[model samples]
Structure formats: structure tokens, C-alpha cells
Target chain A: MQHLLATHPRRRLFQLSPPATKPSREGVFFLPSIRIGLAVLALGGLGAGSLALAQEPPAPSPERSRELIRMVRQDCGSCHGLTLRGGLGSPLLPETLRDKPPDGLKHTILLGRPGTAMPPWKTFLNEAEADWIVAQLLRGFPEESK
Target chain B: MRKALRAWCWAILAFLPLLAWSAEPTLRGTGDLGVIIERSAGRVLIVSTSSNSIISKVEGLGDLSHASVVFSRDARYAYVFGRDGGLSKVDILRGTLEKRIVQGGNSIGGAISQNGRLVAVANYEPGGLKVFTADTLEPVADIPAAYGDNKLSKVVGIADLPGDRFIYSLFDADQIWIADLRDPKAPKVEKFSNIGKAPYDGLVTPDSRHYMAGLFGEDGIALLDTWQPEQGVKRILANYGRGEEKLPVYKMPHLRGWAVAGHQVYLPAIGRHEVLVADTIHWKETARIAVRGQPVFVVARPDGRQVWVNFAFPDNGFVQVIDTLSGKIVQTLEPGKAVLHLEFTPRGETVWASARDDHKVLIYDTASFAKLAELPADSPSGIFFTSRAHRIGF
Candidate 1:
């Protein structure tokens, strides 16, 4: 199963290609089943990558994740605006980030953008943690608890 | 014998009120007061400069990320500019918020007119500046920062001049505009374009004669003579960082933090771990003192004998004191984590520093370099003293 997941050329092509277009008329009948299969394949690919990236970033605990969220809202928010709308730094809203890839955003968080006010957070956050932050930012940041 | 004792007791009781009156503590005047910004909590802690103690806490300010405060002429009121564009008029004496207005979407800071009647805010969003009445904060004049082809530019480094005028640098357009507020309703603007690239922040000289803007895109400062507006702009220290490898700047060095002591002005060397000492008269770099980190605020004491400097992240915990005469790091002290700002008392007897991560404001004796006192704060950053009221563009 692992080998099949790793060597699947069609799945690799789907992952590398731009977002897929509408299915052809001949493939329309099997579209629903194909979609389900693709979803499973994508999940498998994520798992494979998780195992391959040198050392996987531990899934942040609930409390740790909450702290990270607050840090982004307050600390990063210093330059990025409290609402993350935009200030001295550019906006970080989901819409503004639709074109930005998740990996690229994560790299920016870890290494920081040179010649700008964005400082590298590698000392404070791990690669996986940065990935988590990018994911949350893309899906709309969480609000602090009252 | 009983009658005599009773008379004695009555006499002592009569003098008690007089003694009590003599021992009563005198009220602190507004001039002896100062404010410390609590960054995360959206609050300002009013403190007594004499005793170095927190007097009161004014709360409910919006976003204090890059917050700054300027005092009214009487020093009774404080105008706080928040990053979220909230302009709050805090009465320092009454320990209350008099008025607050959301002037724009984002703002770096603001300046009060020399006469203390008009307040001008430098805005990032919607890209313009808005002047308001100092007393009521009522909108007076709206100046859209449009450059070429109706392009709006974010305003930075808005400072007040001696002649009821305000000067500001356009961040995106690379221009400087001096607004004459002799008539608050209608300001006559004198624009100087193509001054420099990316004038991030600026400050007016203590004499209010020279207006210098720090350029981020280049390794120099743009200077304009307020006295000679027709001379256009001059670039100073153009090659200060030439042949040196530039470091990543995690934070922008504030030109307001540059200090003039004696014949020299101390400026934070951009993208370098040093403070450049430049001659005010010659406008040339004389020497540079290596520091622990990228210099943030290089402020001189009121007496002009010593200058204290803070650093950017990773080395923000340390502060170095430079003796102006020696042009060297005389002393280095670690106040605490993230020492964001430093402010001197009216007489320069004491300096107040805020350590944001440690949640404390440390007071140090200027002469002895000893810790005088520490006040607990919530992520404290900027320490502003009422003595700023006397300065033209504080």
C-alpha cells in the first residue's frame, strides 16, 4: 500500500498540476467515485509527506495551540494589525492569501522575509508549528477566548 | 494637680492639627507625571516621576502596537495614538479618558502643534493625515496624501515645527509635506518631492530648524531645513553603511529616538549593530560605537551628558549607556526582556525603561546607573514623560 501510494504517477500528476478542471463527458459517469478516490489518495499523500520530512512537527496540544494563536494575534499583530487586516505590514486575511501556497507561507514564518520587519520565528517556533500557523491563517484565525 | 494635667493635655490637643497640616504630603503637579504604555492590555499607566510609582491606570485603549503619546502644553492631557488608528485624549490629572476618536484604519503616531492647539495624526490606511482640535479632538482639516496621478501615500514621521507648522514624510510617495496650520481650517502645504527612497520615519531637530527623514531603501538620511524651505532636501551620511554587510532588520529604527547631545547627534545605524554619532554642524558621521544588537532607541538624557540605547529582537534585553564626551559605550545594563523604550525625567536625574516581555518598567538613576525602582506593568513598551510638553515636536 505504501509503495503504491508513493509510485502512483496519476496521483503525483494530480498533486503537481494546477487545480483540476471539469471532467470530460466520457468520464462524467465515474466522476463521483473518482473524486472520492482522489480524496483518499490526497490524504495518503499527506501521510507520506508527514513521514518523509526529516522530523515531523509534533501536533500542538490544545493549550499550546491556543498560546500560538494569541502570539500571532498580539505579537505578530503588532506590525500586521490587531485584526490582521493590514498595517505597516501587508494584510494576512484568507482572501489576500488565496494565491499564496501553504508551504510558502510556512517558510516565510520560519525564515522570515528579509529586509522587512518580519523577524525569523525559527528560534521561537518549529517548522511543523509554522505549518500549523499557516494552516490556521489560511482557514481564518481563531478568536481569543473571552 | 488634676486641673494642671488637663490644661496640658488640652494644649497638646490644640497643636495636633497644626502638626498634621505640616506633615501632609503635597500633591504631585502634572509636570512631574509620566505615562507607560501597556501594549497587550490596551492601557496606559500614569506614574509619578518623583517617586517612580504607578499612580493610575487608564484602560480600554484599542491597539497599542506602535502607540505613542504627546502631552498638551499644560501637561494635564495626553494624546495617545494607537496603531489601530484610535486617538485617545487621556486626562492625566483626572486619570480619565476625555475623548477618543477612530481617525483612520491604521496610524503610526502623531504630533501636537507647537502652540498645543492642533493635533496631526500620520495615517497608513486610506493614506492621509487628519488634524484635530487639541482640546476636543474635533476634526479640523483633512489632507489626503496624494502624490502623482492621484496616488495616495501613507504618512509617516509627522512632527510639529516652531511656527505652528507640521512636517511629515510620505512613505509610499517618497515626499515630504509641511503644513502651515496658522489657520486650522485651511492649511497651506509646501511639498518637497523625490527627497529619498522610502522615508520610513523622521524627526525634527531639537531647535526645530532641521527636519531629517530616515530612508529605508537606501543607507542615508534625507534632511530638509525648515528655516530654508527653498534649499530643497539634502542627503546626509549617504555612505555610512557602504562596504558593510546589511543585517535583516526585524524592526524599523525610529528617527524620533535619535538624540542630539552637545555638538553631536546620536543615530541608530540602520541594519547595523552600532550607533552612529554625527556632528550636528557638519552633518557628517564622526564615529560609530558597536552595540550588542541593532539599535532601536538612541535617546539622550535631558542634561545631554549621556545617551542610552536599546536594541532590536534577540538582543532587546540589553541597554548600553554612552558618555557623550567619550563617544564610547560607558556602561551596559540588562534591564529585562524586550526593553522597548527609554525616557528621561524633566531634570535628567532618572531614566525610565519599559521591558515588555518581563512586564516591568525599570527606573535607573542617570548619574549612578543603579536601579532606582521597578513598577509592574502588562507588556509595557513606551515610557513618555510630561516633560515632552515643553519640547516643540515631542
Candidate 2:
């Protein structure tokens, strides 16, 4: 699991902060690492921070990629709508997901949104595979056959 | 005499064509017709239960990802609810699409009123319920599930009740609303906000006396007795897991597929690979039967003699059949890859299951546990039979 997390470029973003020493009245903990990371990036004057953070992961082989694409179109499509138009889950079309950062989408795919029907695919997919899916979704999703 | 015989032969030949026409089967009289949803291909295969053959395949309906169907009272027409919010009325006897309408941006499923006059859909996009005339599919009422400063909540588990009313669970708001469509133009809404947290899905019992909603944010289920609505909702099986960590829920358990056998109800334990048996009289967990994987649909046979269950992804290929009397898994069958849904024949003598990965629908004999036949499908999911016309919620 650790190895899989390392392959994700945005892993550091989630791991930036350490666990809170105490919980608040509402039982929610605030992460200070995110503020520190933002300060560091601002001081470095890196306007292309998002692009730098989205470092491409190791690509899957062509055959393996095709299999992953089919899984997304059929299995993932079960809830996301076969056409990616949205059903129980939100739409996955490029237009609907255009504003979402690629790295964020990758993180979501790896560690599903808690309290929702989305289940983390880290058990079934590697970080690299999830990155591939995010990239495909940003563009147009592939057809099931060709 | 020869000339007279020739004339008679010609007359008999002319009558032969009329005889063949009369011998053709009538659409309305044909019993046990069902529909198999081809999810990816946007088509539905109309199958005859008695012959176990494909009657016809209706096409052009769009985005059947989470498609569901409800039958008309006469069992002649099937109203298919597509994921793209396309409501289509299909004539089972004619094996053709009668009427189609795009009601919403995205819909999960729908229910037909007890009187068979209205069809209501639960939508997620705009977050509301839409009711339409059962015959013409005309818009009757639009009830936006608004709560707390005009915020909309996605509707789930909408089922028709006895009094021309529809009950649905709100996934986002964590409430249940009963919409009385006594007058198709205006519906009286009764909101039960204190039901529980994140009521994912719900279903009305076969007798239509109780409505139960499964909670996602908490353990246990919320129960409402329609006969005694003023008493409010009762929580049942509150500590099902007993503080133990639950297995990660791959997919939300669907209460619509829960089964009732005799005086007991069989339900899929959320996030767990077990089927929980609850007594209808006491509304308490009686027994938990371990199964192969996370149970998706724990459907009871028509006779309520046995219950069939299918699992979630990775373990989706296997199906387990349990004997209701003994509360034990009697047999296990592999119906191929990505087995999504199951439906039983009118008499519950046979079961039909769809394998999405294999692109085939398998039918098995319930009593003998034998493979009966297989029909080729395209990424099939839900198998709905016309017999649903007789049930409370389909």
C-alpha cells in the first residue's frame, strides 16, 4: 500500500500534515502542512505548481491500458452512467470535470471519497493505473471495443 | 363432377391463408413475458418465461446504466427507467416500444402506483421525484426534494404505497418523504426528517404495511409503519455489527432487492459478506448466514421457499442459494463474470441471472438447480419479469 501511494504524484499532498495531537469540539482536525506547503510554493514563485505536482506516473503497457479502459467504460460506467453522463455519481464527461485538477482526480480514484458510494480502488488498481484513468477521463473516455 | 371438385379445392386453398392468421399467438394472452436490460448497448431483450426464448429486442433507448422497469397492472406494458432519465413504455406482447420520454437528467429507478395509474421516478441530477401518467407518460407532478433553505436532496428507494402515494428516501438530507398523489396535479408532502443519517435506499414490504430505509452514515435501518404514521419511525437492528469494524462497502446495498420469506425478511448486511435474517413479527435480527462475498441482492423466490444472493465486484461471478427453512446456503453456482442482477419466473420455479462481462443471461431451474438455457445479451444488468405487475414494489 505504501508503494502504491508513493507512485501517486499527489501522495505528498495528502501526507504533508501529521496527525493532530487533539481533536476539536466538533471532532475535526485541521491540517497545517497544507498551509506550510502553499507558503513554500508561493515563496519559490512557481506559477506552474499544479503542472509540477502532476508528474506523470509510470505508464501501463498498451495491452494493460486497454483492459483498464474497458473496466472504466463497463464497470465504472455502471454507476457513472455508461456514457459518462452521470447517474448515481456525478458526471465524468470532460466538460463536467474540466475544472477539477488531474492530480486531485487521481487522489480521489485512489482513496475514494468517504461517506459516499465511491470505494477506493487502491485495492484493485495501482497508483499508476489510477493516474492513467484520470488522464483518460480528462480527455474523452475510450470506447469499449476500439 | 370434375369441374365441381376443382372449384371446391380452390375455395379451400383461399381459406388456408385466413386459418394461419388466426393461429398466430395474441400478444395480450401470452403470459410470463419479461425484459432483460442490455446496459451498454441501449437495448432490452423481451423474453418469454414459459418458452425461455427471446421474443424481440427493443432498441434506441439511451443510457441504461442503472436501468429498472415496472409493469402495468395488466402485465402488458413495461415502463423502463433509464439512467439518462428516459422513461419508455414498452408493449411486452407486441415486443416494441410504445412511447418514450426524457424526464430528467439522471434517474436511478421508478415505481408504479398501486392503482396502476401513475409512475414516479427518483432523480439525482436536479434532485427530486417526477410523477407521470402510467398510460401516456405525461408529466403529472414535479416535487423537488428541497429541504433547509431550498437545497435539493437526491432521491432514492422510491416505492408506491397503497393509498396512491409514493415513499422515497433522500440520500443527501437523510430523510424520507411520502408524497400523496391523490390528485395528480398537486401532491401533499409529509416529510420525516429525523429518520436517520444518510438513508441510502429503502423499500416497502411485500404487504405494503412497512417501509424500511437502510442507513449509510450509521448502523441499523429506519422502519415506518404506514398504518401508524403518527408513531414516527422506529430504528431496528441498531447494533448489527456490535462495535466491530465493518468491511469496506464496495457498493451500496440495495434494499429494493431484499426478500421476505414467510414471517422473516432476508437482507444484505451492508459492507459485510453475510445475509441477515430478521423476524417480521419482532423486527429483530434472527440469524446471519455467511456467504461467499459482499451480498448485493438477497431476493426471495416467489414461493418464499428459498433466497438467492449475488455478490459485488471481484466476487460478482458467484451466486449462493439459501434454504429459507434451514437458514443455510444450500448451493453455490457460478453464473460467469460480472453477474449484476437476478429475477425469478412468475411461479419462482426458474431464475434468470445476467452476466455483464460474459454478455449472457442464464436461466436455472430452482427446484433441481440445473442450468436450463442461456440467451445472448450485451452487457446485461437488471432482469425484470412482467410478474412484477402483481407485487407491491417492483
What is the per-residue lDDT of model 1 for residues A1-146, given as tens digits with 9 covering 90 to 100? Answer: 21232123235333432222212122121124233443354344333221222122344766777678767876677668666766777777644564776778888898888766576788888887898777556535555542
For residues B237-347, what per-residue lDDT tens digits would candidate 1 score against the true structure?
A: 897888787876766788884398888888888889988888999899999899899988889888799999998876889999999988878899999988888998888
Please list the residue runs of candidate 1 whose C-alpha ends up more than 4 Å from where it truly belongs after superposition: A1-75, A111-126, A142-146, B1-28
Pairs clashing in candidate 1?
A: none
Per-residue accuracy of model 2 over B174-268 as CA lDDT, tens digit each = 89999999998879999898788888888889989999998887888899999999989999988788888777676667887548889999888
DockQ of 1: 0.21
Over 4 Å off in model 2, which ranges?
Answer: A1-59, B1-30
Q: RMSD for each model, in Å, please? A: 10.1, 10.3
lDDT of 2 by residue, A1-146 (tens): 32232123133323332212212222112134223433344233323222232333444765676678778877677667677766566768644565777778988888888877777878889987898687556535556652
How many clashes would you count in candidate 1?
Answer: 0
